[model samples]
Target: MASTVVVIGGGYGGISVAKALDDIADVVLVEPRETFVHNVAALRAAVDPDWTERIFIPYDGLLTRGTVLRDSAVRVRPTAVELRSGTRIVADYIVLATGTRSPYPAKLDVEQAADGAAKLRATRAELARADRVLLLGAGPVGLEFAGEIKSAWPDKAVTVVDPAADLVSGRFPDEFRAELRRQLGELGVELVLGTSLRELPGTDPGRTGGFTVTTGSGVEITADIWFPCYGAAIDTDYLGPELRPARRADGRITVTTDLRLPGQHTVFAVGDVTALPELKMARAAQAHAQVVAENIRTLLQGGGTLASYRPEEDAIVLPLGPKGGVTYASEVGVLGAGPSADLKGGLFLDMYLELLGAVVAR
Candidate 1:
């Protein structure tokens, strides 16, 4: 019998690995969402309603011979993946690539693309009515959201509240940090770092209303709308205790150097579900796919040297909007808006379309 590789997740890493092994192996991709969400562009979608449609791409045309299971994985055993409907898919190898979730606007809570887009449109209406926008969380999502909001409505007052004293400081270079602050200032975004809100808003986030929040420093600020941009809840409940033993305390899985779940060559994990001491970004997940793909290929070929995976260099291409952002690479160090926009600002949709071969997330 031919080898069967079941991939449980249709996110960036899952899609890439499944596509790579489409014809060579009996690839089975299991996921719940109707389409692949280009989550990196989510903030932009929140501000630019027209771009919302492009953030979701169906999985219809992604694989040539591999099967795409449009269902949820309820339990993953050693050799089979059990769905919520109790259907079991026996596999020679399994790839656990289930990703995480973020706040709405940054990530929609819906399963279908249309519903997700509708939510974005509704939030856009709220955003348009609100004058003062408060963003809680200073991570990439928050910063990027502030940039998107400002880029769309330059006159709107945007405040970003973060508990960290510096922007991704200590992780990257000082020049990178300085440039980020400079760009935020140029865009008229106010930063209230080193503190947090004394109390969360009485109203729900992403809702339109008038409310004032007190900060830990006793500074009072009122806003018509606010959004919580941080918090990444990983999806891993499907793994029973036997499978759950592979997961770390943070809900991420412990993988071998070759990306396989320890003690089980037939099981592997990747993407936001992996316990890598790096920012949970799409790029890192894609890197995980490369290693997992190679390792699986070797095992299928009757065993060979499995490739090892390590954190890639400090590389990031953070888009502020369609026209601005920041990026860093070992080849170029940290760069300004021009390079950032050139790499990510323009190619966001086209790149995903190319990845999935113009398939809808169906």
Candidate 2:
């Protein structure tokens, strides 16, 4: 009998691994959403609501041989997974791929889709009515959002606020940061660095309204709207008491070199669920799929050596809207509004999504 592989969380990592092993093993995928959401396109879709339908793809067409379970996994033992609907599935090898969570609409629950759509529409209307826009945080998401807004409405007064003393500090070289500042200036994006918001101004966060925001350094500024852009929270409450130590101080699971839970070789973890010392991105989840599929394959082919998974140190590529962005490939870091943008913002996103059997026809 072939080995049964039960993979939970049909996100980037889970789907990739299941597709890779569907032909070789009896693969079972557990996911909650009816469609696979191409998150890279979600932000852009928010600007052009017509393209929103394209970002959602039906998972039925992804893996022909694998089984898809449109349910949530509530418990995971060494050998099986218990679904929230009280369904239990037994497997020879188990993979825990339940990733993290982000702010609403971008990566929140499906039920919030209506709220997200309404917020996006309101934001667009607000942007049309307002003269200035303020964004909190300089992370990739915040920067990308600012870039998209500027590209769509070049005349709008756009300002990015971040407490970091330097933009993308320690992530890029001085030259790159300087170039980014120049580019933002050229785009009329006022960047207020080294300033922290003491309190969130009371106003329609998604609407055009007058609001005053105070910074940590006593710098006061007023804007029409503001958004909080921060890191995501990893969801692991379903793990229960299987691996107590898996939850690190930062609330992430720790995996071994082979991507398996330490001391529990039969069980494995991947994607945002693992406490890997690397940036949490969709590309990283794809990389995890390669290691996970290979390891599972090795386990099924009798006794064999398993390849270890090592995350790249400086693999950061940020696409800033549809025309520009930055990329840090190992020691070489390149910053511009062209190379990174054209690659990801233009065509690469669609290509990557198509590769995963999810694409929106333009």
Candidate 3:
């Protein structure tokens, strides 16, 4: 009999690993959301609701030979996973891929997945009525949000404020950063780098409304609304005392080179749940899938040797809305624009969904 591989969380990494091992093992994917939200396109969906419909991929058609459970894992032991619904699943190997969470609109919730796409579409009406926008945090999420806003509504005032002295500091080369600044300037996005916010004078900090935000530089920028694009809270509350002493500095579970917990080969972790020093993006999750899948295969085949996962030092890609963006690799940068953005950046969400056998409209 083939070994049962239970994969927790239905994010990019979980789904990819399950799909790859569907033919070789009895794969069980545990997730609470009825539909998997393509988080990569969540920012774009926030800017344009029409894009939201394509952001969610239902798991019903995902695996031809595997099974998907519409429940969340509350406790994960070495050989089994206890569901929140009091159900239990015994497995030969357990792959934990429970990713991080952000704010509501930024990251869709499980309940929101029901009609979250529709909610994003409805938000289009709200975003269109607003004239000025305030985005806190100059990280990739904030930068992508700004890019999406500029692409959808160029006339709207978009200001990105960050406490960091430099935008995308040290991650991208100097010339790449300059190019990013140039693009932001051409798109009419006001970059307010190296600044702190005193407070927001808006009534609805979550919703778009006429508001004024004061900065540490004594300049107040007024906007219709502001969004928080900083800080990521990882979802690792399920792992009990069985694996507590192996967390890295980033609050992520520490894993070995083979993506397995040290001294716990039966238990593996991937995606944002791991303590790797790589960017916690969907693309990185995909890369993690390839490594984790091979290790699982080796373990299932009697464990000759496990493969190690080495994350690329400089693998970064910023999709600036639907028209253009940038990609950085190994100290070199490439500007992705026009068809390139639509082909790779835009459809990346769709492509992965399709690869997972989800219903994705071209």
Candidate 4:
């Protein structure tokens, strides 16, 4: 009999490993969502209704021999998984890929694809009616959202406010930050850094209404709609007491160079949930998936050594909109707007669609 591998969560890393192991293992992918949300394209979907439907791809064709369980994990054991539906599945190996949760329009909180798309359409309508917009974060999410808004409605005023004095903190070079500001300025995006709102806006995010907010520096700003674009927390509550000890104070799970839990051979983790010292991006998550898949495949085949994953230098492919943005890689430093747009402007929607074998009517 083939080895049974139960993979938890259907995010970027989850889907990649599941697909890769389907041919070799009795892959059982457990997830609650009815479709795979291409969250990389979520910001564009919020501004363009055409992209709303394209981002949510059904998981029907992801596996031919494996099974896709429309359920969530309630608890995980060393060699078994307990589902919320009261079903217990025994496995030779297990993978935990539950990623992080971010603010709306970047990562939807809904489980079903239709519901998520409806929320995006509603938010798009709200954006269309609004004039001035206030985004509360200068991070990548906030900057990308501002870019999407400006691209869709260039005439509308878009302002981004963050408590950090600089954009994209960390090892990113100063040239990258300066170029990012240049592109955002070219798109007429206003930046209010080194300060934050005294309090949140009275109007709910993605809704249109007039509200004025004061900054910590005593600066007053008015806007029709406001969005909080920061804060992403790991999702790992399903880990039982046996596995819970592996989680750090920051909520990220600890894994070895081979991406396995400490002292465990059959259990592993990947993506943002792992305690890897790298930016929590989809590309990095997928890379983790590749490493984990290779190691598992070798173990199942009975004698090869497991592969190790090393954290790469900081890299980013931030697209401002369909026609603007910036790209950064440690090897090549930072590229200008043209390369950024060409690389991720369409948000890699087609690539994901093809990966899952999702067919959409053009």
Candidate 5:
């Protein structure tokens, strides 16, 4: 009999490993969402309704032999998984890939694709009515949201306030930060870093209403709408006592270089849920999936050698709207707006659509 492999959470990493193992193992992928959310495009989706429809791809065509279970995992054991609906799945091997959760517009907080798309449309409508916007974080999501908003509505006043003292932290070079500030300045997006709001705005985020907020430094700012772009946490609360000890204080699961849980040979983890010292991005998740798949494949073949994963050099393809942004890699250092736009302008929707076997609409 073939080995039964159960993959929890059908996010980027989960789907990649499941598809890679479907032909060899009895792959079972469990996910809660009705459709795969291409959250990389979510920022643009909030500004353009056209992208909302394209970002949510159905899982029907993702696997030929593997099974995709539309259910949530309530608990995961060493060799089995218990679902919220009381179904227990026995497996020869298990993979944990439950990714992190971010604020809306960066990541839709809804389960169903239709509901998420509807929410984006409603938020877009609300955004259309606002003349001034306040974003409460200066991270990638916040900056990306500001860029998308400015791209859609250039005349609108967009201010990004963060308690962090620098843009994008000190991860990138000073040159990169300067270039980022330069672009934002050109787009008329204001940056108010090193300070936080004294209190949240009275109006709910994504809702259109006039509200005034004071910063920690006693700077008053008024905006017609606001959004929170921070506070992303990994989703791993369902691990049972047997496996819970492997989780770090930050909620990321500790895995070996081979991507398997230490001392638990048959259990593995990947993506943002892993305690890897790397940026939590979709590309990194997929890379983790590749290593996990290879290791599992070796084990299935009577275990010759296992593959290991190493953190890649810091790289980012951040897009400001569709035509502007920056790209940075260890090899290239940093490239200007033209390269960034060409690399991720369309948010790689077509590539992901092809990977999911969805027909790309022209």
Candidate 6:
């Protein structure tokens, strides 16, 4: 009998591994949503509500030989997964790829894609009506969101507040940070760093209203629209008690050198669910999927030396809207606008479609 591989969560990592092993094994992918949420374009989608539908790619075109279960995995054991519908599936190898969740409109709280689209449309309307926008976090999400708003509405006052004292990541070179600052200045964005908020705004994010909050530095900031842009909760509550210790202090699962759960070689974890030393980005997660896929393929072929995963030290590519952004890699120290745009502009949509084996209509 062929080895049955069951993969959970059809996000970037899950889908990538499943696609890699589709022809080699009986792959079963358990995912809740009917569509793959392309989180890379989420900020841009928020600014342009019409583009919301494009961010959600149907899972229908993903794997030709694999079966996708449009259901959530409520509990996962060493050898099987129990669905919320109470159905249990036994597999020879199980992959835990349930990623993390971020604040909307970067991520959707709704499980259904249609509902998610509706929420983005509503938020876009709110953004369109508001003249002043405040983003409460200076991480990639917050900075990119501020740029998105500025790109959509040039005159809108945008302020980014973060306790951290820097704009670009400190790990990157000074040239990278300098370029980031120049881009933000061109967009007319005011960044309030090294200062903590005394109290959070009473108004909910994405809602149009006047609100003022004082910073620890004795500066008062006000805006009509505000959003909380940082905070990612890993999705691992579905794992059984046996895997509890596998969950680390940082909320990510500890995987072996080969990306398998320690002691349980048949079970593996990937994406934001794993305690990878690297930054948790879709790019890194997909790389994890590649490594996991190779290991699983070896297991299916009856044992071979599994390849270990080593994260790239400075693999950070952030694109703010289609035109502006920054990128950093050791091979090429701190790339400029052209490189950033080339790396992560509208190309994401095309790349995903190709990955799904779908051809776009010209």
Which candidate achieves the best lDDT against the true structure? 4
> What TM-score would every model get versus the actual structure?
0.96, 0.92, 0.94, 0.98, 0.98, 0.97
Off by over 4 Å in 2: 105-108, 111-123
**Residue pairs with clashing backbones, model 6:** none
Q: What TM-score does model 6 achieve against the real structure?
A: 0.97
Q: Where does model 3 exceed 4 Å of error?
A: 248-250, 336-345
Q: Give per-residue lDDT, candidate 5, residue 212.
A: 94
In model 2, state the lDDT of residue 99. 90
Model 6 C-alpha lDDT per residue in residues 9-105, reported as the tens digit of each score: 9888999999999989999999988788888888988988557888778788888878999898898888888998889998899999999999998
Q: After superposition, how far is residue 110 of candidate 1 from its true place, in Å?
A: 0.9
Per-residue C-alpha lDDT of model 1 across residues 1-362, encoded as one tens digit per residue:
67999999999899989988887799999987888888888888888866778888878889999888889898898898899877898889999999888888777788888888898899999999999999998878888899899999999999999888877633688888788888999999999998999899888888989999989987888899999988889878788667788877778888888888888868989898888777788888988998889888888888978899997666777777777888877788998988888898753677779988884342
Query: For model 1, where is the 10-residue window of minimal lDDT?
Result: 166-175
**Model 1: residues >4 Å from true position, as ranges?**
359-362
User: Relative to the unseen true structure, what is the C-alpha lDDT of residue 230 in candidate 5, on a scale of 0 to 100?
Assistant: 90
Candidate 6, which segments miss by more than 4 Å at Cα?
168-170, 359-362
On residues 34-53, what C-alpha lDDT tens digit does candidate 2 reach at each position? 76766766666656666556
Residue pairs whose backbone atoms clash in candidate 4: none
- Stretches off by above 4 angstroms in model 5 are 360-362
Candidate 6 least-lDDT 10 residues? 353-362
For each candidate, C-alpha RMSD in Å?
A: 1.8, 2.2, 1.9, 0.9, 1.0, 1.4
Relative to the true structure, candidate 3 reaches a TM of 0.94
Q: For residue 88, give model 3's deviation from the true position in Å.
A: 1.1
